[model samples]
Target: MRLVTYRRSIEAEARLGVLVDDLVIDVATLGERAGSPLPSRMLDFIKLGPVAVSELGFLLKEAGGRWPVNGALPLAGVILLAPIPRPDKNVFGIGLNYIDHVAESAAALDTAPDLPKQPVIFSKPPTSVIAPGEPIVHRADITQQLDWEVELAAIIGTTAQRVTRENALSHVFGYTVLIDMSARDCRRAGQWIYSKGQDSYCPMGPCIVTADEIPDPQTLDLWLTVNGVEKQRNNTSHMLFKVDELIADISQGITLEPGDIIATGTPEGVGAGRNPQEWVWPGDVIEAEATGIGKLRHPVVAG
Candidate 1:
């Protein structure tokens, strides 16, 4: 069952939704009829543990047939929001997780070591997140160069601390696609905070696909395109530190809670790594896609 966060209007309350076919089921409305009202917010519902997820699975099965369809709407009827619109903490990201990407970045920096000793982790403030189809505001005033990164984002289903690699997969709730928009000029100065923390720097989600559906996260295909031209394309199998290892490594000291997003880094085709160097300009429409998880599109606009 695919889970979502959405609303009918900007001022309308954000509610939990489940996508079945082309329909978005209002879990809260359905729950009310069953006398077991589910939480309106996706994060709150996720905090309820696996039982809630299990119940959602059952709901998805019975939805169109016996369940009330009053609150259900076609996918185009409502506004889709980020799976976790308001993340509890900064979103975690891994840099140079792909071997080819590491080589490219190293070459650009005139450095050595095709691969890093450990995963390079950084944080993107929650406010950087924007919904799919939303505009990724280009920070043109302060940044002369803007870049795009298409990455697969992992969502934590439960609290995890010092988790072993063997048990890390079980802690994952689902997966979503995140476009990690970057300001290359600001990033070259060192700290990735200001470079990546700009408003709408992260365009995330069409919806979250449950982890049960993905037996092996590393085998999926991911791609990104700007305007009508393809830019980045690769499989997750190339990741130096796969999903399980990334989770275990990150949880070694920090506790990962439900709804926490982890972008597993991008592959080698970023614009910044090109021979002549390329950056996105205002009015560019970018689309990022991952097999099974679906696609995310964002339009670039001057800040």
Candidate 2:
């Protein structure tokens, strides 16, 4: 099942939803009706692990493949929010993990083209995350060079510490599309938090496709576009450090808990790597997608 967090209006509380075709099934109410209540928040729901997932499957089967009119809302009628709207901690990110992206950065930023022996990890504050259809804030006073990176985000379902690479994927709950927005000029002394961690810098969601549906995340296709023009396109197969390696490496000492997200590095063709070097300015729209996860579209707006 494709899971989501959504609200019917600005004043409504965000609720957990399961996508069934073009409809959003209210998971909480559905469970309540089945005499097995479920959490309304995505994070809380994720913490329940496979049992909750199994229950959802049972509920769907019990429904006989049909939902009452009031039980499921039209996908267009709800405001889709970030699956985990506010992570307990910062969002983990991998940098320069795509071979071609590293090469492009070398040419554009005057850096060496050598691939790193280990994964380069970074963090983005929770505030940077925004939902689909939200505006990506462009602070003119702070940055004139805004860039975009289309990445596949992995959400952890179980606690992981010192996990082996072979067993790493079992800890993942699902996958979603995440656009890493950057202020190219804000980097200082090689640190990226200032450039990539500002509010609304992350545009995530459409919905989280459970890991069960995407057995091999590496084979998926992903791409990004600006104002109807394609800019980045590549398969997850091109990633220099795959998802399993990332999860295993990250959990060596630090713990990865439920609802934690890891954004596997983006592929080549970012605005910063273009021949003429483009930037996303106010009024432009960015649309990015990963095969089964779906697309995220956000307008660029002045801060």
Alpha-carbon lDDT, every model: 0.87, 0.93
**In candidate 2, what are the lDDT values of residues 1-303, reduced to their tens digit?**
899999988999999999998889999888988898889889998999999999998998899867745779999999999998998989999999999999998898665689989899889999999999999999999999999999999999999999999999999999999999989899988888999999999999989999999999999999999999999999999899999999999999789999999999999998889889999999999999999899999999999
Cα lDDT of model 1 by residue, 1-303, tens digit: 688899888899888888877888888888887777788888998788888888767665665456575778888888999989989999998988988888877877443556788888989999999987889887667887789899999999999999999999999989999988888778654668787888899899989998889978999999999997999999999999999999999999999999888999999998888898889989999999999988898889887
> Each model's RMSD to truth, in Å?
1.4, 1.0
* TM-scores, each model vs. reference: 0.96, 0.98
Q: Which candidate is the best by lDDT?
A: 2
Q: Give residue 200's lDDT in candidate 2 (0 to 100).
A: 97
Model 1 misplacement above 4 A: 110-112
